[model samples]
Target: MEGNDLQRDGVARVLLWGAVLLAVAAGMRYGLLENGLLPRDCLAPGSPVAPCAFKTALVQSFLHQRLGWVSLVLGGLAFATAGRRLAWAGWLSGLSGLILYSYEPAAVGAMLALLVLARPRGEQRH
Candidate 1:
Protein backbone atom coordinates (compact mmCIF):
# COMPACT_ATOMS: atom_id res chain seq x y z
CA MET A 1 0.00 0.00 0.00
CA GLU A 2 2.77 2.44 0.83
CA GLY A 3 4.52 1.65 -2.43
CA ASN A 4 1.40 2.36 -4.37
CA ASP A 5 0.93 5.69 -2.66
CA LEU A 6 4.46 6.73 -3.56
CA GLN A 7 3.89 5.71 -7.17
CA ARG A 8 0.73 7.79 -7.37
CA ASP A 9 2.58 10.70 -5.86
CA GLY A 10 5.24 10.43 -8.55
CA VAL A 11 2.64 10.66 -11.29
CA ALA A 12 1.04 13.74 -9.81
CA ARG A 13 4.24 15.76 -9.87
CA VAL A 14 4.70 15.14 -13.57
CA LEU A 15 1.23 16.41 -14.36
CA LEU A 16 1.93 19.65 -12.52
CA TRP A 17 5.06 20.26 -14.54
CA GLY A 18 3.08 19.68 -17.72
CA ALA A 19 0.58 22.31 -16.65
CA VAL A 20 3.33 24.88 -16.05
CA LEU A 21 4.75 24.34 -19.50
CA LEU A 22 1.33 24.64 -21.07
CA ALA A 23 0.73 27.93 -19.31
CA VAL A 24 4.00 29.39 -20.55
CA ALA A 25 3.26 28.43 -24.14
CA ALA A 26 -0.26 29.85 -23.96
CA GLY A 27 0.98 33.13 -22.49
CA MET A 28 3.52 33.58 -25.25
CA ARG A 29 0.96 32.93 -27.98
CA TYR A 30 -1.51 35.43 -26.51
CA GLY A 31 1.13 38.12 -25.92
CA LEU A 32 2.37 38.03 -29.48
CA LEU A 33 -1.10 38.06 -30.95
CA GLU A 34 -1.94 41.21 -29.02
CA ASN A 35 0.85 43.78 -29.07
CA GLY A 36 1.27 47.50 -29.61
CA LEU A 37 1.33 48.08 -33.35
CA LEU A 38 1.62 51.49 -34.92
CA PRO A 39 -0.70 52.21 -37.85
CA ARG A 40 0.63 50.93 -41.14
CA ASP A 41 1.20 54.42 -42.53
CA CYS A 42 1.36 56.81 -39.57
CA LEU A 43 4.98 56.01 -38.80
CA ALA A 44 7.76 58.57 -39.16
CA PRO A 45 10.79 56.90 -37.51
CA GLY A 46 9.65 57.43 -33.87
CA SER A 47 5.96 57.99 -34.16
CA PRO A 48 3.70 57.33 -31.18
CA VAL A 49 1.88 54.03 -31.12
CA ALA A 50 -1.68 54.04 -32.40
CA PRO A 51 -4.45 54.19 -29.82
CA CYS A 52 -6.48 51.22 -31.10
CA ALA A 53 -3.51 48.90 -30.77
CA PHE A 54 -2.08 50.26 -27.54
CA LYS A 55 -5.38 50.15 -25.74
CA THR A 56 -5.69 46.48 -26.58
CA ALA A 57 -3.26 45.53 -23.86
CA LEU A 58 -4.50 44.22 -20.51
CA VAL A 59 -1.13 44.38 -18.70
CA GLN A 60 -1.81 40.84 -17.68
CA SER A 61 -0.36 39.65 -20.98
CA PHE A 62 3.07 41.00 -20.10
CA LEU A 63 2.98 39.91 -16.48
CA HIS A 64 1.58 36.43 -17.16
CA GLN A 65 4.36 35.56 -19.59
CA ARG A 66 7.02 36.24 -16.98
CA LEU A 67 5.11 34.53 -14.20
CA GLY A 68 4.49 31.53 -16.40
CA TRP A 69 8.20 31.10 -17.09
CA VAL A 70 9.07 31.12 -13.40
CA SER A 71 6.23 28.76 -12.63
CA LEU A 72 7.53 26.30 -15.23
CA VAL A 73 10.93 26.13 -13.56
CA LEU A 74 9.30 25.64 -10.18
CA GLY A 75 7.09 23.00 -11.72
CA GLY A 76 10.14 21.23 -13.07
CA LEU A 77 11.61 21.13 -9.60
CA ALA A 78 8.35 19.78 -8.25
CA PHE A 79 8.24 17.13 -10.96
CA ALA A 80 11.71 15.96 -10.05
CA THR A 81 10.90 15.86 -6.37
CA ALA A 82 9.32 12.77 -4.77
CA GLY A 83 7.42 13.72 -1.68
CA ARG A 84 4.04 14.95 -0.55
CA ARG A 85 5.48 18.28 0.53
CA LEU A 86 7.08 18.89 -2.84
CA ALA A 87 3.86 17.96 -4.53
CA TRP A 88 2.10 20.67 -2.58
CA ALA A 89 4.79 23.11 -3.60
CA GLY A 90 4.17 22.31 -7.22
CA TRP A 91 0.44 22.60 -6.68
CA LEU A 92 0.87 26.03 -5.15
CA SER A 93 3.09 27.14 -7.98
CA GLY A 94 0.59 25.88 -10.53
CA LEU A 95 -2.31 27.64 -8.82
CA SER A 96 -0.38 30.91 -8.61
CA GLY A 97 0.76 30.50 -12.18
CA LEU A 98 -2.80 30.08 -13.25
CA ILE A 99 -3.89 33.14 -11.31
CA LEU A 100 -1.11 35.44 -12.48
CA TYR A 101 -0.85 34.14 -16.01
CA SER A 102 -4.35 33.23 -17.08
CA TYR A 103 -6.24 36.06 -18.80
CA GLU A 104 -9.77 36.49 -20.12
CA PRO A 105 -9.77 32.87 -21.31
CA ALA A 106 -10.11 31.22 -17.90
CA ALA A 107 -10.16 27.63 -19.13
CA VAL A 108 -6.39 27.43 -18.96
CA GLY A 109 -6.45 28.95 -15.50
CA ALA A 110 -8.80 26.32 -14.10
CA MET A 111 -7.03 23.53 -15.91
CA LEU A 112 -3.61 24.53 -14.63
CA ALA A 113 -4.80 24.74 -11.06
CA LEU A 114 -6.62 21.42 -11.28
CA LEU A 115 -3.63 19.66 -12.80
CA VAL A 116 -1.36 20.88 -10.03
CA LEU A 117 -3.78 19.85 -7.34
CA ALA A 118 -4.26 16.42 -8.87
CA ARG A 119 -0.65 15.65 -9.82
CA PRO A 120 1.40 13.22 -7.76
CA ARG A 121 3.52 14.92 -5.17
CA GLY A 122 5.78 12.02 -4.31
CA GLU A 123 6.91 10.95 -0.86
CA GLN A 124 10.41 11.10 0.50
CA ARG A 125 11.34 7.60 1.59
CA HIS A 126 12.95 7.84 4.96
Candidate 2:
Protein backbone atom coordinates (compact mmCIF):
# COMPACT_ATOMS: atom_id res chain seq x y z
CA MET A 1 0.00 0.00 0.00
CA GLU A 2 1.00 3.63 -0.16
CA GLY A 3 1.72 3.72 3.58
CA ASN A 4 4.04 0.77 3.29
CA ASP A 5 5.85 2.41 0.43
CA LEU A 6 6.22 5.59 2.40
CA GLN A 7 7.62 3.70 5.33
CA ARG A 8 10.07 1.92 3.11
CA ASP A 9 11.13 5.22 1.56
CA GLY A 10 11.71 6.76 4.95
CA VAL A 11 13.77 3.82 6.13
CA ALA A 12 15.79 3.86 2.94
CA ARG A 13 16.51 7.53 3.30
CA VAL A 14 17.68 7.06 6.87
CA LEU A 15 19.91 4.18 5.87
CA LEU A 16 21.40 6.09 2.96
CA TRP A 17 22.12 9.09 5.14
CA GLY A 18 23.74 6.87 7.74
CA ALA A 19 25.90 5.25 5.11
CA VAL A 20 27.11 8.60 3.84
CA LEU A 21 27.96 9.72 7.34
CA LEU A 22 29.86 6.51 8.02
CA ALA A 23 31.86 6.88 4.83
CA VAL A 24 32.82 10.42 5.68
CA ALA A 25 33.81 9.44 9.20
CA ALA A 26 35.92 6.59 7.89
CA GLY A 27 37.70 8.89 5.46
CA MET A 28 38.43 11.41 8.18
CA ARG A 29 39.66 8.80 10.63
CA TYR A 30 41.60 6.53 8.29
CA GLY A 31 42.47 8.41 5.12
CA LEU A 32 43.38 11.57 6.97
CA LEU A 33 44.28 10.75 10.57
CA GLU A 34 45.48 7.13 10.57
CA ASN A 35 47.14 7.51 7.19
CA GLY A 36 49.11 10.44 8.59
CA LEU A 37 48.03 12.62 5.73
CA LEU A 38 47.77 15.39 8.23
CA PRO A 39 51.08 16.78 9.41
CA ARG A 40 51.83 16.70 13.15
CA ASP A 41 52.18 20.45 13.17
CA CYS A 42 48.60 20.71 11.94
CA LEU A 43 47.41 19.71 15.41
CA ALA A 44 49.59 22.14 17.25
CA PRO A 45 47.92 24.86 19.30
CA GLY A 46 47.10 28.18 17.64
CA SER A 47 47.42 26.80 14.15
CA PRO A 48 46.82 29.57 11.66
CA VAL A 49 45.76 27.37 8.76
CA ALA A 50 42.01 26.92 8.31
CA PRO A 51 42.27 23.32 7.17
CA CYS A 52 44.46 22.45 10.12
CA ALA A 53 42.05 24.07 12.49
CA PHE A 54 39.20 22.00 11.11
CA LYS A 55 41.24 18.82 11.25
CA THR A 56 42.33 19.59 14.77
CA ALA A 57 38.73 20.07 15.84
CA LEU A 58 37.81 16.72 14.36
CA VAL A 59 40.74 15.08 16.14
CA GLN A 60 39.85 16.63 19.46
CA SER A 61 36.25 15.49 19.24
CA PHE A 62 37.21 11.83 19.63
CA LEU A 63 39.62 12.46 22.47
CA HIS A 64 38.71 11.34 26.00
CA GLN A 65 35.89 9.18 24.56
CA ARG A 66 33.63 12.19 24.16
CA LEU A 67 32.12 11.01 20.90
CA GLY A 68 31.29 7.61 22.42
CA TRP A 69 29.52 9.20 25.35
CA VAL A 70 27.60 11.52 23.03
CA SER A 71 26.59 8.65 20.80
CA LEU A 72 25.44 6.61 23.80
CA VAL A 73 23.36 9.46 25.13
CA LEU A 74 21.73 10.17 21.78
CA GLY A 75 21.10 6.48 21.18
CA GLY A 76 19.54 6.10 24.58
CA LEU A 77 17.25 9.01 23.90
CA ALA A 78 16.28 7.60 20.52
CA PHE A 79 15.59 4.19 22.06
CA ALA A 80 13.48 5.68 24.78
CA THR A 81 11.47 7.92 22.48
CA ALA A 82 11.72 6.24 19.08
CA GLY A 83 11.76 9.57 17.34
CA ARG A 84 12.90 9.44 13.75
CA ARG A 85 15.18 12.45 14.01
CA LEU A 86 16.75 11.26 17.23
CA ALA A 87 17.26 7.80 15.80
CA TRP A 88 19.03 9.23 12.76
CA ALA A 89 21.22 11.44 14.94
CA GLY A 90 22.11 8.50 17.19
CA TRP A 91 22.90 6.25 14.23
CA LEU A 92 25.16 8.86 12.63
CA SER A 93 26.90 9.64 15.87
CA GLY A 94 27.38 5.94 16.64
CA LEU A 95 28.87 5.27 13.23
CA SER A 96 31.27 8.19 13.51
CA GLY A 97 32.27 7.21 17.06
CA LEU A 98 32.98 3.64 16.05
CA ILE A 99 35.27 4.71 13.24
CA LEU A 100 37.00 7.39 15.32
CA TYR A 101 38.30 5.12 18.13
CA SER A 102 35.33 5.21 20.48
CA TYR A 103 33.94 1.77 19.80
CA GLU A 104 32.81 0.67 23.26
CA PRO A 105 29.82 2.89 23.91
CA ALA A 106 29.51 3.49 20.19
CA ALA A 107 28.74 -0.19 19.64
CA VAL A 108 25.95 -0.14 22.20
CA GLY A 109 24.63 3.11 20.81
CA ALA A 110 24.63 1.80 17.28
CA MET A 111 22.78 -1.31 18.41
CA LEU A 112 20.14 0.73 20.16
CA ALA A 113 19.72 2.97 17.14
CA LEU A 114 19.39 -0.05 14.86
CA LEU A 115 16.75 -1.55 17.10
CA VAL A 116 14.73 1.61 16.98
CA LEU A 117 15.19 1.93 13.25
CA ALA A 118 14.11 -1.67 12.64
CA ARG A 119 10.79 -1.29 14.34
CA PRO A 120 7.64 -1.10 12.20
CA ARG A 121 6.56 2.38 11.29
CA GLY A 122 3.26 2.08 13.12
CA GLU A 123 4.98 0.87 16.26
CA GLN A 124 7.44 3.75 16.18
CA ARG A 125 4.79 6.18 17.31
CA HIS A 126 4.03 6.55 21.01
Q: Pick by lDDT: which candidate is best?
A: 2
The runs of at least 3 residues in candidate 1 whose Cα sits more than 4 Å from the true structure, single-residue gaps closed, are 2-64, 83-86, 102-126
- Clash number for candidate 1: 6
What are the clashing pairs of model 1? 12-119, 12-120, 13-120, 82-122, 83-122, 83-123
lDDT by residue (70-124, candidate 1, tens digit) is 4455445544553344445445444545544443333333333445445433534
Worst 10 residues of 1 by lDDT: 103-112
Return the top candidate by TM-score. Answer: 2
| Candidate 2 root-mean-square deviation in Å | 3.2
Candidate 2 residue pairs in clash (backbone atoms < 3 Å): none
